[model samples]
Structures are given as C-alpha cells and as structure tokens.
Target: MNYAIAYVVYNPTVEQIERINEISFGHPVYVYDNSETISELPYNKDIVLVRNGRNDGIAVGLNILLETASGDGRSHIITMDQDSLIDDHFIKKLISLAGVDDREIIVAPMHHTGDITYDKDLVGKSSQKLYVLTTMTSGNLLNVQFAIDVGKFEEKYFIDYVDHEFCLRANRKGYKVVISKDLKMEHSLGHSEQKFSLLSLEFVPTFHAPVRRIYMTRNRSDVWRKYFAIYPRWVLRDFMRFNKELLGIVVFEDNKLIKVYSIVAGFYLFIMNRWGKAELRYLVNGAKK
Candidate 1:
C-alpha cells in the first residue's frame, strides 16, 4: 500500500525543496509551507504544498495537516524538517516497520553529521520514556487514527519540547513510540545553540538563549502538571539536576539570574495558570546586564 506523505516545510528556500524533491520519490507528498506567504513550488504532480498566512510554529503547522487529513485515512504521515535529506531506503523501511497495523504510526530515524543517539536505556524506565516502540514525530511517521486520537500535536507548545509532548501524549494512549535504529536521515544539529557547548557534544546547552530557557523550563512544568502528576518525583529530580547543571554552568552560558528565573517562572506558570511572559521580559533585562 502507498503511504501518503504529509511533509511540513517551513520557510524553505528553492534549493532546499529541490534537494527534498530529489530524494522523495514513489510517494504522494503533501507539503505545508509555514512561511508568512507561500512561494511557487517547482513541478511535481504528486507533491501538494499548502501555505499558512503567518509563521506558525512547527507544532501548530503539523496540527493543521493532521486536521486536514484526519478522516481521509492516508496510511501514515511522515513529519520532516525542510533541511532533512532522506536516505534512499527511507520509505521501504517505514513501510516495513509499519507492520500489520494499517493505522500504525512509524517514526523515521534522523542522523546528524556528528554523534546522535536516542537514550535507549531510558526506553521503559525513565521520565524520558514516552512509549516503547519505533519512532518520534520530530521527524517520524504517524498513523492517521492514532494522530487524530491524540488530538494531534499541541499547538500551545509553539516549538521546543513539542515532540516530547506529543510522544508523552501518545504513550498515555498506549500507542507505541519507538526509535528506528536502522533507518536514518541526516539532520543539521543546533541551528540555534552553536556557541554553548559544555562537553563538545552537539546537544544544546539549556541556557543558550534566555528566551529558549524560559520556554523550555515553563513548558516542561506544564507537561508535568497536565500529564506526569502521578510521577511527581520525575519533575523534582529534573529540577534538582538542572540546578546542579546551572551551578556548574558546564554546557550553557552561565547566566544565574536567567536560570533562576526559568525555574521560578516554570513553577509560577504551573501554580498560577499564567504563561510567565512578564517574567521572561524581566529575565531578558537581567540577561542584558
């Protein structure tokens, strides 16, 4: 059976699309452009591009495609970033891992130029464990029914940890979320956190951007309140670990005020039902100092 690809492309230049078109063959591609306005796509009858009037974050953009294809039953939808280059065996592996469930969600493996590995050790035991299965929607595939059942990606996340949030939701619904160790696509690491590395590893330092720190810390609290209430220790442990890291200032820029603000704001948002945007501004001023 042919799987219709619901590919999300945001602010893609012509060159990026050409690279994507070259690699993606033997599938009906639905391209959703999340730019302020849509650009003219190069010819490909099988490819369909949709435009958003404004720049919605990746999570919201994906929700649009999910809503559009909710009932139409199109095998599985493969989420991707515009910069990703698909390996030749990509689709075949996806179909293979899809298994017997026509409504199954199959996630693709993403490879970067440097070392990148999913913490398989955390599979069933850690707070990181969403579900034990095949992939994550960050650049993974999803069954239509499963996607709809989870009510699609939460648009409230905007960006950052949205993938983690989706996986958490899928896990709650007993959907299997696994990592495909065999199939791999190349990804560019850290379009944002090039400067802040603690151990020379590619992962971003939590304190790289004051804005990102605010979002990450705040949204994570939201995740705990909404989903992990049963596992209260998880958030507490993470909070302690983060404080240690902040004191060390190992990987990220050492911004004590910003770090404290992140934690406090995250907590405040949880208890007060507010976003802590004002706190973010205050932290921004402190960061400037």
Candidate 2:
C-alpha cells in the first residue's frame, strides 16, 4: 500500500502544486516538469522534483518518474495529471480495490469533470466492478512491475491517446484494467461547450489547440490499426467517437476550416507512418488562425 505518487507537469498552476503537496502526505511524490523553465517546488522532503528544459511529452515524463520510483524500491505508482484533485482517502480506497483482484494491473477511479465522465455505467455500481479496455492516465493506480514488463508508456505518442495506447498494450499482455466504482476524483478533460441538434445534444471540445488535434487524430489512428484485429468492437466504438468529435469541431467550433485541415493532415501523416511532433507548418498555420 506504500505507493509513490507521480505526475507530469507542464506550466502547472500554484493550486496544482499545493494540491500535490496536500495529497502526497505520507508517500513519496515525484514531479516531472516538462516546462520550458524550471520553477520552485514546495519545501517537502518527500517530494522529488525533476526539471526537463523543454516539453518532452507526458509519456517520456511519466516513464522517467516510473524509473525513479522503481529505483526507490516502490512497488506501485499512482499517476495523475497536474490539475486533478483527489479525495483525501483516494489512495486508501484504490489500495482496497486493488486487493480484490490479483489480475488487475491498473485500477482507475471514476473521473468527473463538468459534463464529461468516464465509465458512466459503472458510476453507481459500486458492488459490481467491471473490466474495462482503457481509462485516462490521471487517477489510475499502476503496478510498477506490470508497467515495466509492458515496456512503460510509449514515447512516440506525444500526448493524446498515450494512456489508451498503454491500456491497449496492457490488455494485449493479459493484464486486467479494473474500474473502481466506489472511488471517484475530480478531473478536467478540455474546455467543452454544449451544442444542440434537432434530436440530440453534443459537447463540442474546442479547448485543445490545432496541434493537439493533430496528435489526437494521428495517435488514435495508429492505436486503432494496432489493435483492430484483437479489439474490433472497441475499435469500432472509438471510430464512431472520432467521427462525432470531428462533427463537433466542424459544426460547433470556431476556426473550423483550420481544424478540419489539421485533422486531415493528421490522418495523412498516420497513413504515411509519421510520428512525433507535428510539422512546423501545421503549428504555424494553427497559430495564425
């Protein structure tokens, strides 16, 4: 139950730093900063802060934190986003649920952010836990050994879909991804707005920049291709979800043409087997728009 807390931060806010100090009372907290400039951390002996001069993406930062935690003889590491808020008993609840399933390699808490929620069916089904394909990175308790065996998070995915890629890899390795309905946390996904059609309502996510859209589109395609045969149902579900998001961007969001172009460019890059940071033209054009 003595797990280390790890989070990758990029230009984090003061409240985030304070929350990290608060939740990491008796555990060692590793802070991997991907900001362009280093900032001062709270004066806590249990908190280990590492500064990367530039943004290396969440996967690389998380892997670094995992390596550091492993070297410190930690068996489990709880990975979270910088802005997420956890309950005071979050770790204790997660540890309890972890003991119920020996095959569980990653235990995720129910995430609530605005109107967005993960695992809606499992929300009040506290007595009935379910095996899921994937969950978000924040508020997920990862088994250190299982992570290492699965080769850690994929660095090629700069940000978007990094967690999904890890979860899919975990599933392929015969590791169970469990959802704890009883445990919940407050987390934010993106700046979303509600848009209404004649018969339905959709939340348009316009918060992410064009660069992030490129990553989301590209990484999603790569992940789908990798696991489509083994997880056809899940892949199909995601395909529909991707189309819905595209519709939202096209219909409800501003700078619609640029985002559509970025999405198309992302798919094109994926078809060409390209990865890593997007081209400068994409970023430049997006910025101009």
Most lDDT-accurate candidate: 2
lDDT for residue 51 in candidate 2, whole number 0-100: 79
Compose the digit string of candidate 2's lDDT tens values, residues 1-289: 7578888988887777878887667667888888896556553556898875888899999999889978888878889888787665887777666656666788888776555445532212346565778788998889888899999998988889999889888888988888776777876666654445623765646566777788899999999999999888778878987887887777677777777888887898899888777767766555432
Local distance difference test scores for all models: 0.59, 0.78
Estimate TM-scores for all models.
Answer: 0.72, 0.90
In model 2, which range of ten residues has the least summed lDDT?
117-126
TM-score of 2: 0.90
lDDT of 1 by residue, 1-289 (tens): 4456666766688887876676556666777777776567663655766675665677777877776665455657777777765654776676677754333354546444343345531345223223342233545777767877877877766656677667666766666665566666666543334433345533344344555555566677677667657444445655664565455453345665665666666566556765423343545555422
Query: Candidate 1: deviation at residue 8, Å?
Result: 2.7
Clashes of each: 6, 0
Candidate RMSDs in Å, in order, are 5.3, 2.8
Mark the regions of model 2 whose C-alpha exceeds 4 Å error after superposition.
40-45, 113-126, 193-195, 198-201, 204-206
Error of 1 at 232 (Å): 5.3
